[model samples]
Target: MSSENDWNEDLCGCMNDGGTCLYGFCCTPCLFGANAEKISEKNCCLMCCLYLVLGSVYLCWVPHYFERQKLREKYNLKSNPSCGDCPTTLLCSPCALCQEARELKARESVQRSALKANNNQPVVSQPEANSGEADHVNMRV
Candidate 1:
């Protein structure tokens, strides 16, 4: 990991992005699902189902905590001393989800702008075609 980068926004800065804040506030499960999909690069439906199921038993924070860790690692963000991932996700899930979504959006914007500046091409993050499956073929002559 490289030097730690501060979060682009604060946890309670949901109002910064009204759309994301509304989604997270109105439909928490959906928000969690979307964030999980981006963070884990897994099936969106599967992640949504898992979040809904575990949320019933108050265990949704488990996966969310891991996702937060992943975000920290990817951005090389320092851990919050006052409120770690587990506590934040467990206690204030909506805020946490909103923060993660905002961070992802900001990162994507930065990437797109950089690409555009370098070349007049629009580059977007595409999902992996193989979905992590090994590509192999058996050839018999």
Candidate 2:
């Protein structure tokens, strides 16, 4: 609650001589005025160090963070790749097994389809022989 006048008076008394206060807080102009430019230089150096450290942190984190974010946006909602919907049988559909099985299945299905198509052809009919000559003679008469 001290007034400005009292503060100024204290400052003036502390600076009456060229000497500084016992605690080194007050002087003719200022206790730190002699080294003001040095203080500013040190602050600038500290700011540069802070900026360098922060830049390094940001640079190191950017690629991984962006890649992870992209992956999350791309595949986050998908089902587990390790688990499939349909049950895995001895011979799975669209199976990840060897190519031989798939090729064999394809060949078998093609052969079966070809067989079915061949069997679907129309049959040729022929006339039957008469059991007796009388029947033939009666028909002729």
Candidate 3:
């Protein structure tokens, strides 16, 4: 039901979401950990530790590349001919991680909205007023 020729956001669109941009800039390991967790449906701490430890040895990119490829395939994303997972993950690790995080975040939000709509629930609930009357009640003398 999804197209395989497009990415939800451009690689350079890291600043589109301030929170994600900040997290990616300040703590990339944490961002990657969160992304990996979301993608694998695993524990965030475990993913974070794995990334941090293996990433230090330079072989971590292998796993990251595979994960990125998996995400692209799962989401029906267009493959980057010039800059595939290897180069993207190895050369520009932060940017690649940011892009993946953005994609996952967008996908989750879209799914949530779709589910809410399908359930016939308002996206935002309105508070009910008591007594169906104005707040200005007159006191009888």
Clashes of 1: 0
Q: How far is each candidate from the true structure, as Cα RMSD in Å?
A: 10.5, 40.3, 10.5
Off by over 4 Å in 2: 1-97, 125-127, 132-141
lDDT of 1 at 18: 98
Best by TM-score: 1
- Which candidate order results from sorting by TM-score in descending order? 1, 3, 2
Question: On lDDT, who's better, 2 or 3?
Answer: 3
Ranking by lDDT: 1, 3, 2
Q: Tell me each candidate's TM-score.
A: 0.81, 0.22, 0.77
Off by over 4 Å in 3: 1-3, 121-141
TM-score of 1: 0.81
Report lDDT (CA) for all predictions: 0.87, 0.32, 0.81
Candidate 3 per-residue lDDT, tens place, 56-109, comes to 897667767877888887787898888888888888878888899999988999
TM-score, structure 2 vs. true: 0.22
Against the true structure, candidate 3 reaches a TM-score of 0.77
